[model samples]
Target: MTRPLLDVRDLRVTFHIRREGDLPWTQPRELHAVGGVDFSLAPGETLGVVGESGCGKSTLARALIGLVPAEGQAEWIDGKDLIGLSPRQMMKYRNDIQMVFQDPLASLNPRMTVGQIIAEPLTTHHPGLKRAEVKERVKAMMEKVGLLPNQINRYPHEFSGGQCQRIGIARALIVEPKLIICDEPVSALDVSIQAQVINLLIRLQRELGLALIFIAHDLSVVKHISDRVMVLYLGRVMEIASSDDLYAAPQHPYTQALLSAVPVPDPAHDMAASVVPLAGDLPSPLAPPSGCVFRTRCPRATERCAAEVPVLSGAGHQTACHFPGPLTEAEIAFARRTEAA
Candidate 1:
């Protein structure tokens, strides 16, 4: 087995918020953004994180990079625990881990030219390099990510959504990080552009042997770029399995519903037949249900689900649910009817 580059165990991120209430001083509520996510990534491997919005996908990414305060262990193979590191302390690992944000243009500074933006990381991490060296490396990275050297002087607004994303990719790669966290990097672009950026990342990953944590709500996109897929819901991991296994046979109710919602490409395919209907909206993380966080909306949820929290367990493919497997025909029918009513 290739040694894992990053091993994350029981990682959690919580936030305290105070909302207006009848009392003079309302007690702050704890919002569990990430309740305990565990996974590992080997060099050159890609881990796809899929869930609905607000399911802690971005939070988990931010936690790993130390953008948010996180608890539990995120041990880098090189003997450093990533959790609870100060910004100054994290500077040591900045070159090893990088992030590509969701909005490309927004993530880049409009005032800076493309060259300046891409070269910023190099300057920060390798300040001793000569000016000529920085410019040469920046131009090389620009070409690597499908950008023309002539466009280096152009501002972000001068480029298209996809091109801006290319610039972000160039910026992240210039540092030559071992792992890159892509938080929905292609979500804001057109379908064609999404494909282009995703393909670019795939090619870059292959060529550079970089590990990636691709977070996206698009299951089809995730399936295309990921070796393993992890399903999260209400700050908890619902299921984790190899990309082929998870899509072919998802065991958790939440995972089933998420995959069922993915649009089928075949026009003749029966969409309704494949869907595992889920009733009710996602519960508030501030007051997540007592046992299982997903029970409030899960069709297979029972007294056992509400009475006991399911620990993520299993050998290769893991699921955190009292009853894990494909939804039964009866259960599917009942869920569909319940949604209709």
Candidate 2:
């Protein structure tokens, strides 16, 4: 096997929030945005992160790139821990890790021309390079990401949403980062545009040999572009497995429900019959369930699930569920008929 490019363990990101009208002395509530997520990425591999809106998919990505204050180890293959790095300290590794944010237009500065935006990273990292060299590289990157060299002088507002995203891709790639964390890169695009961006990313990964952490709510897109898919609930991983394995035989109840919600393209397929209904809203992270964060909504959850936390175990396909395996037929039926408590 090729050596892993990045290995992360026990990664956690917590935020302290003080509500309105609270006394100065009142203790702030701790919101665990990411609770011990662990994963590894090989060179040129894509790991898709899928979950509900509040799950820590974005947090995990931010934690990896030092955008958020995180705890635990995110060891780069070069023998550096990414967590807790100061801004100056992180500058050294900025070229090795880059992020493409969800809002393409917002991520790009409207005041700056496309050339300047794409060339910004190069200027930051390779400050000694002459302006001419930076412009040539920027134009080359723009062409690579499907933008015309002549349009480099145009501002972000001049382009359509999809074109703006291509510009964002160019900026991220301009630095030639080894790993690119795409936080819902395609979610904001039109459905047709989403496919274009996704294909662009896949091609870029292939040509550039880049590893990607693709976080999105669209499972079908994730399945298409990812070698492995990880399912998160609240702030913890529910299942992590190969795209084919996890989608084919989802072991965790939460994973099963999530997969079931993916719309089947076939017109004749009974979408309603295939769905595994989940109960209740996601529990607030401030006071998550003690044992299993997913237990409150999982039909298969039992007494043991509520008392003891399940460790993510298994060789090839890891799942953090006390009863890890495919949901039985009866359980699916029960979940479908059950209403929120």
| Highest TM-score model number | 2
Q: Look at candidate 1 and tell me the lDDT of residue 266.
A: 97
TM-score (all chains, Cα) for each model: 0.97, 0.98
Model 1 TM-score relative to the real fold? 0.97
Candidate 1 lDDT over residue span 1-341, tens digit each: 87689999999999988776636577677999999899988888999999999999999999999989999999997878989888888898988999999999999999999999999999999999999999999999999999999888899999999999999999999999999999999999999999999999999999999999999999999999999999999889999999999999999988988899999999999998888778888888988998999888888778988899999999889999889988888989988998888
Measured on C-alpha atoms, candidate 1 has an lDDT of 0.93
Clashing pairs in model 2, backbone N/Cα/C closer than 3 A: none
Error of 2 at 132 (Å): 0.9
Across residues 1-341, which tens digit of lDDT does each residue of candidate 2 receive? 76688989999999999999999999999999999998888888999999999999998988888878999998888878888888998898889998999998999998999999999999999989999999999999999989999998999999999999999999999989999999999999999999999999999999999999999999999999999999999989999999999989999989988988899899999998888889778989999998999999888888998899999999879999999877899998888778533
TM-score of 2: 0.98
What's each prediction's clash count?
A: 0, 0
Cα deviation of 139, candidate 2, in Å: 0.5
